[model samples]
Target: MPENTPLLSVRDLSKTYQAASGPVEAIGSITFDVRPGELVCIVGPSGCGKTTLLKCLAGLLAPTSGSVTLDGAEVREPPKKMALVFQEYGRSLYPWLTVRDNVALPLKARGVPKAERQALVERAVEEVGLGHAMTTYPWQLSGGMQQRVAIARAVAYQPEILVMDEPFAAVDAQTRADLEDLVRRVWKDLGVTVLFVTHDIDESVYLGERVLVLSSSPTFVQEDLTVDLPAERDQLTTRALPRFTELRTHVYEQIQRAKRGEAVAATP
Candidate 1:
């Protein structure tokens, strides 16, 4: 791979499930790339295989056809260079473990040294503003704080890419907004490539440098809209701005089209 090549790439990726009812295709052929340090969001209608794509990218589920590559190597299993955060924070974090312990588990799995793991865990928790809750268990924290601990754990792993699967869907609106901002801050500060999947058009537009819209079931890429807003996005001011509104409207329209099973143009 060239130095400037994407840290992760997907080509003709598809997933199918065999049920007693017969074969069910979840995702159809789709291809895209996530360049180093880029924040890309995938959005589509419910049951459009957004989560399936994330699973394929994370190597949690093998695609029925096509391929996913990480750092120019075909991803056959979970890559050490990638970390995933799911929608259910409660299920994702271990209730029996302290926040600090949960955050440090990935490092431990990777066999990182004790001193280095401690430092990384501390830094990640501090970055996510969960330093005060480090000793608390997941059950003791609010929904938002639990999610932050989950994110802090992913970050502590120091993965080259961070994949989030509708991570804010379980939180209240206010907490969701704060978590979105927190994700952006961490993405910028860490300079890690991010692949986020969400059903919320506004959320995708607000968070992504490029928002990818997928077609309905047996999904494929429908559109990829580059968010042309300034790098520093303020939730209030940015959302109220003309450009942000325009971008959000574009993604919203595309998603509406997808829900109707209409063909939409891909990003230029």
Candidate 2:
């Protein structure tokens, strides 16, 4: 593929489930593109099909209509080039395995040699600032640390795209800030395309190169707002910038408008 091509593309994607009442549409036809090494944050009102869209992108759930393509290939199943980090790290990480082994599992599944797996695990752990916790179990660490282990696991897989679903939603304010910085740093250092789904307006503005807002249920793309923040983001300095505040306020108002039953036109 050409270097300028998008790393991922969602074309007219929509998901509808057959419920007892009637056809329950999770998202209306949605379309968007994530370019190579770009950080895109998706924000939407409650029950706006954010999770459904994510599942479609990750190939966890097939879309009722349309399709998702990664690296110019249709996503029929979970692609090895992508990795996902869910909100519930407590359930995601295996309690029985030490941090190093947990991060190494995906590598092992891919048939990586022992030495290569160990080296990757070491690098991933250090990237997340968990080098000292490599010997610790998931249950032995704090919630934030456990999430870092989960991130390390994803990193060790060496995926080209990282999909994070509310990864910082459960952490305390301070911890969330630290994790956000960690993700930004790692994404830049590794040049991985990232699609982050979060409900937090501030977070979306602080971390994304652009923010995509989804309308209420039967969701479609409401707006695609570019975040004009600096690439070198600091938790304190970035968040304090007037531009950050402006972007965040726009996203917040859009969500509120979406919840009020405003019809959102799909973006081309």
Candidate 3:
């Protein structure tokens, strides 16, 4: 794929579910593109159908109209070249499996050879700074460490695009910061395309090269604002920047407007 072309494209996508009460619209229409090796964060008002949009992108659910295409292929089911990391680390990891086995599960399922799988697992685990706990079980690790294991699992899959659904939401503030840095490091090191969904305005601003803000349900993209922060960022120094404050404040104001039923047109 050309570097300038979108690695993932979503166009005119919408979802309406058949509910007991009546047809319920979640995403009214959404359009966005994630280019190769870009780290894009998605933020929205509460109940703005972020998860619903993610599900459609991952091909876990079909859209009512429009389309999600990964690379050049339409995504009708979970794509093998894509990997997902959910927020609930405790639920995603296996209590019975050691860290190595948990991280190796996806590779093994894809029919990766034992020797090659072990190498990928080891490298991914080390990348996430969990090399010392390769034998530790999920039940024995801290919540943050467990989330690291989940991230390692996704990394080992060697996905072309990684879609993370609020993966840091369950950790403490300090741990969340650490995990956020870890994501940046891995993204830089591996050059994987990342589409992260989070409800955190500050986090979205801090982590993304561009932040796509969604409006209240039935939702449409409220704004697709470029985050002009430096490419290299640290929690303390980056957050202290005056530009960072302006960006977050802008995103917050957009969310407020969205909640008030004000919406801009979907990006074409």
TM-score top scorer: 3
Residue-level lDDT of model 1, residues 193-249, one tens digit each, is 899999988999899999988999988899877899989989899999999988888
Taking all chains together, each candidate's TM-score versus the true structure is: 0.97, 0.97, 0.98
lDDT of 3 by residue, 1-268 (tens): 7788999999989999999999999999998899999999999988999999999999999999999989899999999989999989999898999999999999999999999999999999999999999998998999999999999999999999999999999899999999999999989999999999999999999999999999999888878899989999999999999999999999999999998986767546
Candidate No. with top lDDT = 3
Model 1: runs farther than 4 Å from truth? 1-3, 264-268
Encode model 2's per-residue lDDT on 51-169: one tens digit a residue.
88888899999899898989889999999999999999999998899999899999999999999999999999999998998898999999999999999999989999999999999
TM-score of 3: 0.98
Evaluation by TM-score, superior candidate among 2 and 3: 3
Q: Which residue runs of candidate 3 sit more than 4 Å off their true CA positions?
A: none
- At residue 130, candidate 3 shows an lDDT of 95
Clash totals, every prediction: 0, 0, 0
The C-alpha lDDT values of all candidates are 0.91, 0.90, 0.94
- Candidate 3 global Cα RMSD: 1.0
